[model samples]
Structure formats: C-alpha cells, structure tokens
Target: MNELQNFDFEGNEVRTVLINGEPYFVGKDVATAIGYQNTRKAIKDHVKTKYMREERIVTPSGTQTMTVISEPGIYQLAGQSKLPTADPFQDWIYEEVLPSIRKHGAYLTDEKIEEALLNPDTIISLATQLKNEREGRLIAEQQVKEFQPKVSYYDKVLSNDALMTISLIAKDYGMSGAGMNKLLHELGVQYRQGGTWLLYAKYQRTGWTHSETKMVPRKDGTEKAVLNTKWTQKGRLGLYELLKTNGYLPLIEMKDESAV
Candidate 1:
C-alpha cells in the first residue's frame, strides 16, 4: 500500500493510491464517482478478486480496511456501469488520470531529471549511467538465453492483455501450465503445437484464436520463428466464464462486515 491521495474527477473527490508499484483507486470512491448507489454491490458483481485487495489504512479515528482495485478492475467495473456518465468517466480515467499518475508519481523536486539535462557534466554522467544500464541489461538477457526454463506442467504465466499465452491464462486462476492444458483438453481444445495452445476447430470458427510468428534467439545467437497462440478479448472472457462455472477459480466470498 502507498500513501492515499485525493484528486478531483468531474468535481468528485476520488481517492487514489499505489499498490505493488502500480496505481489503484479506492473501490468505494470509484463506485460513488460512477454514480453507483451501493459500493459493495458494484464491487461484488463486477470486480475479480485477484484485481481487488483489502488493506488497512489509518484514518482520523484509527484504522480501517478499505477495498482497492487495480487498473484492470477499475476498467472491468466501468464496463458494467450503466450510468449516463459511464463512457466519459471511463475515458477520463483511461486518457487522463492513469497517465498523470504514472508520469507524476516519479516526480522529485529536489533531484530533478530536467535540471540534470541542462548541465553538460550531468549529461555526461547520465550517458555513462545509461550505457552501464544497457550493458547490465544485455548481460541479464544473455544469461536468460543461456538457460531457458524447463517447462513446468503447472506454473504461473505472466503477460499483459495484448498478447496472452497459455501460462498467462493458467496463472490468472492459480492453475499450473500443465493443469491449464489438461483443463483445456477437457474443454475440447485439441491441438497444441510448439508450446502454443490451440482451440478446437469449432471454437476457432468464430475467429477468436489466432497464431502469430515471434522471433526467438537460438542457442547459436540466431533468430528463429515461433508461432504463438493468442486469444481475442471475447475468447478470454468466455474462457474465464467457463473456468469460473467449473469452479476453477478460488471461491470469492464477501468479507465479514465485522472484520472490516
């Protein structure tokens, strides 16, 4: 948890904080800003538990547990909003608030990068620092290339929305890579070639699954072609629902009122 800050959104005071190095908005404040009457109802219906977490924060009285949502959770809630200002609110969050938080959060008035940029000595020192950083990064990459991970049957995957891999889907629901593959097979996914998971032809008929070629470096330091399977947004949501109904996701129960 990071320090909580308040900023105005359409004249409404919205609470924002940083969690795990990423910005998150207070769930109750978000619901209020979006014109929802019941914060708990809005959260329970729309937010994924993985994207929401509870933390104790000190207030005027003492301390209280507050629900906070990551950026993804906020957007998910926005999608469920039926208020007249829903679209504009979503746009304001996406186009304005998020960017400002990301940009200004790193601001340091006493040790400013802009001030350094104006001095020749500082410019030379910065260039040297950048070169060292690049070299360190290259060394790290080379080390990783030298030892590709032994594929785990059940392991968490890390990825963003743009291009999701099998590991990404599995990790989302606390499944292993192998477990996800087995679950997919049970769900009628038939083909998986070269570390890529493929949907059944019937599921693919909707054009929800596709493959793209990505370049991977060989042990000999040459690039090779690798086809990666990706799921469309529709496919991802559908798969999530399928898993949800099947009890693959951990049970998400409402917090006890007394506990809060």
Candidate 2:
C-alpha cells in the first residue's frame, strides 16, 4: 500500500501511511505534534519495538526508512506523552484521524484478479465466483462507511491524562457502577455478569481491549485472580460519543487549551 493521509492535530500536520493493509504513522511527526523537542529521543525512549517499526516511506525527497507507529503504538505514546495537549491530542487521534484514514485510504481495496481471468479458457463458474466476491466486498465496504459516525462526532468530549475506570465514566453520566454497566451493554461495548465486566463477543473477537490479571481479596480473606478490563483510548472516546448521543452531558467543562 502506497497511500498517505494527513490530519491536523493540535494545529500541526500529522502524516500517516498505509502499509500492508494497516496504518502506520510517522514517528517524528507524531513526536513533534505531541510537543517533544527531541523527536528521535522521545521515540527511542518511549515507543516499544513492537509499536515502532522502521519502514521505507516515499517522500518528496525520496524513499527513506522512517520510524512508524502502529495504532496500538500511537495509544502507548499518548499515554506516555507529558505535554499539556497530550490528552486532547490522543482523543483527536482515536476519534478523528484514524476514522478519516480508514474512510479515505485506497489500500482497503482488494487486489485485482483480472490477470487470472484474462485466459480465453476461463470457465464461466470461476468468473461468476470472482464477480460475486467483488460484489460482496463492495457491499461490506458500503456497510462500514454507512455505520461510521459523522465528522462532528470526532470532537473531544473528555480530557484526562490516564485511563478512565468504569466508575469514572458512570459518574460523568450521574449513574452508578451497575447502571454504567447496563449503559455499556446497551451500547454493545461490554456487559456485567457476576460483578465482572465481560467484553461483548464482537469486541472479544476484535481484540479491542487490554486485560490484566489482578489479585483481589475476597470476603473470605482469600485472594482470587480477577481479570481487569481496562478501556483503551479509542474505547473511552467511543463510549463518550455513545453517552452524549443518549443525553449524558458532562457535569464539568473540559479545560480550555486554546492558548496552548
């Protein structure tokens, strides 16, 4: 994939490139946007190897190996960023930038099968199957495009430097923890069963969250292993959007960082 997409974050241009059916962002650009004075140093110190990969990207000068960060890597960097605008910038990344790239990137198209079907002896059945496959892909693409939220939905809702717990999110909506779980269920994000937050089946299959094993003391004075469900940056923004749509307004206004 040779496609590139650019978006504005914190009044700076952030460039993303499509590589191998996935979006990889330029590390230097990301670092600069997040207010790091030393781009290479920040990436080397904070970004993990798995999150940061070196790849040859085409540029006006020429193709060169640049450090690129995967989606998860971007979130990790956001968590580590210390700049004042880090939180809001992260919200923009998960809400506006990624969706825009996925919506406009040309790499999502399937490889052409025309060469294989150019033979004179190409069977009618094979041709029909290929045609059906193309039609199915088109339909799926259309469905995805229709399912995405409008551009305005990308606006930042909450501003926090750390991950939000279930209780925190609930408190924002004037609901209890249990009530919040129900709200999450209604939004298809997760459900509560046996006092545990279980990710919905669809999200489980998609690997949208990070789970950790925590030892919790039971009423019987015995420690039991519990799986903690931590909501990612993207997941938090998504829930924020869902709540806003369902009439949940923020009790406190977010900090105004326009001057920054």
**TM-score for each predicted model, relative to the true structure:** 0.43, 0.42
Clashing pairs in 1: 153-178, 154-176, 154-177, 155-176, 155-177
Cα lDDT listed for each candidate: 0.65, 0.65
Model 1 segments more than 4 A misplaced: 60-62, 104-260
Question: lDDT value for candidate 2?
Answer: 0.65
How large is the C-alpha RMSD of every model relative to the true structure?
19.9, 13.4
Give the per-residue lDDT digits (tens) of candidate 2, residues 14-68.
Answer: 8898775567899988888888899888888767797788887777767788889
Candidate 2 segments whose C-alpha is farther than 4 A from its true place: 1-3, 104-260
Displacement of residue 22 (Cα, Å) in model 1 is 0.7
Shift of residue 93 alpha carbon in model 2, Å: 0.9
Candidate 1 residue lDDT tens string, 11-117 = 88778776544567889988888888998998988788987999876555667789988766776676666588766777788678866764633422235567776
